[model samples]
Target: MVTEYESALEVAERLNRLTPGEFEKRTGLFSTGAEAVENAVKIARTWTGRDAIVVLGHAYHGRTLLTMTMTGKNVPYKEGFGPFAPEVYRVPSPYPYRWAGAATTETGIAEEAFEQLVDQITTQVGTANVAAIIVEPVQGEGGFIVLPEGYMTKVAQFAKENGIVFIADEIQAGLARTGDLFAVDHEGVVPDIVLTAKALAAGMPLSAVTGRAEIMDSVRAGGLGGTYAGNPVACAAAIAALDVIVDEDLPGRARHIEEVVMPRLKELQAECAAIGDVRGRGAMLAMEFVVPGTRTPDPDAAKKVAAHANARGVLTLTAGTYSNVIRLLPPLVISDDLLEDALDVLAEATRTLA
Candidate 1:
């Protein structure tokens, strides 16, 4: 087991070299994504002097009490777990596949509609007491929904103008998984705080919350830290992972995954009317299952598709509050041949479902 007391400073130093912008001015790392999120909220509360946090629909932050309240989809996770952290509110996610017409024609998917929902929540919740508006740039558990292109910028602007911290939950899609160091980077928007994890240490367990210095510093010195927050072994692995990402050009690899998988997914869409949507960014892809000849979500079909793929030696996961979305999370190190093989399995699974 990786020692909890190991030094992560060296790894953080090296990560600074790989993606210098993320922590160019930061001084430390975090233990897990959950810890990072907790700290991010604490800092936001401090910065805005607000006690409430608002998150978008279908989000999955972590399993901690605070996170469970922020998680939009409840099934195996939030069930029987109540009396969660207070002041945690949920709003609609501008998921085009599910939330139709949320984007404008000129601006793309109606992110403004999402922002309007946030605005309404802020007004109702009393913006003065709202500390932050948290969201996943690409909703991971919500069917790999990519927010409209300009949504992040507009949301950030709204938050700033309203004195609310804007946090981007990039835990699942960051660390170069989406062809950019961070998914928010794709939209050219800077978040007050960016939460990262999962692929950051490759297979190691490490997560972080990097943000503007002022907001991060607002938390008292003793307020944001943990015993194993920056464990050395995970740090070392994370440093190595960052190096691999840059040296092996995994961002390009992610783009390649998108290129290879999208066509096949689209083909599946064409062949099967039961496939409702083909969406995602870079390597994080998903297909929404639906009733044949209708848009009604068919989670039962999705389960069959996943079981068929697993039986064929390809592991798959299901997401979405309805559990009708099939998600693909192959390692970035997967070979092109293997990638193609996995896609074939997925296609075959889709056919079986059809």
Candidate 2:
């Protein structure tokens, strides 16, 4: 227990440095990303004295009952799950490829998306009755859907004006994975509660919820914890992983990855009719597969392409709400040669599927 406290303190100090302000920050460690997110909701509800939690379309938080309820997809993740937690509302994301059904300006999408979100919240769940607006700056399971420019800023402003806690679910796009310490950094939007996991402990089964000290303290001391939360071993691993991310400037590396991967995927899109969209940021990128000459999703193409790549020793994963997107989450420390080789395998796989 003494070691756990000490290690957690060290990890908290590291996280505070990355957070935007000098104000006191509170962090609660957990065993997985889902657990940490659930706790964030609990804190938001406790602090705001509300029950409704707002999430964006196609968002994937976790598989736990409450988090699953928060997820936007109905298949696979929530097929048979019954009686999910109530008061969770969803709004359309600024998905440029599918939202407006035509090419549009980023600024226009940002404004329109925000307006729709506000309208939904107002009509579906009153602001005073809402606890939090959870956002995945880059929707992990939603084809690495990066929020439109300025969209996040507007959402954060709305949350602040309406007294709703802005929760940034950075579980997948965080810790330098999106060319930023946090995805919201690109827009200079600081969330009230920031969730971290996946890479935080370098695969050591760790997750964290860091938020404003006051909001976090809203719950009684004994009200926010778990039996295995903040395990000493995981804390130590996180400290080391964080040190490496900073010392090596992993965010910069992610930018390099975006530079290398985006163009190649775009070129492939031009050549392969099934490649409908190439989007995402940093190492978190994806290509949404679609039927030729139309916008219909092509999950079969995505699956075949991923299988082709994996069979040849290059691992790839299929994602998105429709399972028509091949999401690429490469290791931040990957060598240039290895990345190029992986891309070659994917290119071959994509062409083969065609």
Candidate 3:
């Protein structure tokens, strides 16, 4: 039984300190990732006086109407949820492993694909009416797809040039989950608006939309806020979580997890023929399961591996539009030995399924 009189402002102030010297940002709190995203779009549309938004293929924004329309997958997230919000558009994401014409290496397609994406958006949506372009720096439910190098910078530039807000949906990859306070930090790309949740309040149902002051202030006073939008209890938890992330150097911990997990997953990829790709950054990693000797997605194999891991006391999750990617989102504070043990279980599951 928490009251509204707690400390939402205090938490916002602390979050403000987390990323100093970048953008002069103001923070708004929400009860879930979806709320933050929905509000972000409102703010973007209000600021730009536009009606259209651009999203990428295989993205997972949230399950609400607008966010679901913004999402790319159809099976569980958007199966029967139509008729969706209007004026939302989708474009191709640079998934290195699956880009048709590009080299299928760890570093996937580059400038050519980016230019093509821009062309597609410009041709299809016409940049003048676009309010924002939202993207997940690391596609979470889309199988941990890390944007190719230079992709973020180019997208941000395009958004700025077009007067469209660039909103980075960091719900699943922010708050030190990706070896940085935000995944966009890795590439030195600054977004006009950033939506964060999942790990923000130490598992509490708290999310935030932090952005350039002008963009954030564009919304009318009553246009933002819900009854529990910034509940004080969740804010308190978020404050404590922020302290731990900074004081304990959790971003460094995430990097250490990447160093420990990536190699192991890669070795497993070498041994497991069903593994089509291994990619991600920091602790937000995943392996895409494909048919042996082919690029066909093998969702069945992913299911089997996840089931096996679960039965063995290692809970796992499957992602991707095709449901063939096994994502590893270990906690940032997980002990190395425990993580290694979990990896061992995952390796065994991969081998057994293969």
Candidate 4:
């Protein structure tokens, strides 16, 4: 067993506080989101004695070997990274914006997507060999594609029925990013394992895999550890940061950000046909750029819009498999005035192209 530090214990306690008595909570701290994600997969594989893992299209887990293999995008993340780890499978992403204006709501589209995934699993990868179904409640690097209502619940139920460990890769959406402590909370879905990082420690290099006792403890002694996994300084920072999340009501702040910014984004979308879609919740939001009057992705427009926003002191990121999505990831703590100011700049930028 790895020697436990006091701060690490405190950090675990703080994280557990979010789900009091929900499960026998055990957390393994790591220095990066990739490490936490990879460890969670390891735990799932060990506990279930299975090998295959499932991920959704447009998903972005991380850059490590196993995590990158789990990721669904190619190009910068997986290109030339070759001979990747095996046993990772892909599913259709319920991305409504790009669903070709199908005769379905987001919920309907999600049902179809899951059905396709089930078919693939049954045919391509034996269902019994599946170890986990990992998802980000909101796709981040994949352009903040929020899962439709009931989609996460459906996935959770499937995992339960199949005895598959369900993981919420909340590294980007948890900790009040979506106006909820965890994005899955909005869907009332409780994953077997939740990987957290990014905002967890107020920017400190700390990530964690918190899960059920049985699965976490199933690993043999010495199965999980790193020389700097749970560095005391980072753990201490995480503790304080978690406190701030509670004391300052960061979750509520996130909601406030959504309330203040979402309408403005929608209004901006009304004025620009190039804005193929505007989505996301709380401080994490996005706008997908497409050719005017068509859904064909326009990476040039996305790049130009981001450049314009950046020139005006509003930072943005281009995302998605086609890189035609400009994602808005403003700080949750941004004041209403500042957030609006940034949005105003973005609005002007979009209009310049409109």
Model 3, 1-354: lDDT tens digits are: 134454788777766666523667898888999999999999999999999989998999999999999999998998887999999988888888888765565344767567776897789888898999998999999899999888888888988998999998989988899999889889888888888887888989898888889999998777888778887778888888888999999999999999999999999999989999998999999999999999999999999999999999899999998999989999999998999899999989988976
Candidate 2 has its poorest 10 consecutive residues by lDDT at 98-107
Taking every candidate in turn, the Cα RMSD to the unseen true structure, in Å, is 2.7, 1.3, 2.0, 1.4
**Higher-TM-score candidate among 3 and 4?**
4
TM-score per prediction, in order, is 0.92, 0.97, 0.96, 0.97
Point to the candidate with the largest lDDT. 2
lDDT of 2 by residue, 1-354 (tens): 324588988888788778655678888888899998999999999999999999999999999999999998889999989789988999989988888734388788888889989988998788889999999999999888888899999999889998999999999999999999888898899899999998999999889999999999999868877777888899999999999999999999999999999999998999999998999999999999999998999999999999999999999899999999999989999999999999999999998887
Among all windows of ten consecutive residues in candidate 1, which has the lowest summed lDDT? 18-27
Estimate, for each residue in 1-354, the C-alpha lDDT of model 4 and write its tens digit.
167899998888777668423877898899999999999999999999999999998899999899889888888999999899989999888888876435379878888877877889889998899999999999998988998888888888989999899999999999998998888888889889999998888899999999988999999988998888888988888888888888999889988988888898889889999988989987788888999898898999999999999998898889988899998878877887898899889989999999
Lowest summed lDDT over 10 consecutive residues: which window, candidate 4? Answer: 14-23
lDDT of 1 by residue, 98-155 (tens): 6565343526655565556667775778777789988888888877888877777777
Order of models, best TM-score first: 2, 4, 3, 1
lDDT for each candidate structure: 0.80, 0.91, 0.88, 0.88
RMSD of 3: 2.0
Model 3 residue pairs with clashes = none
User: What is the Cα-based lDDT of residue 169 in candidate 1?
Assistant: 83
Which segments of model 4 are wrong by more than 4 Å?
19-21, 100-103
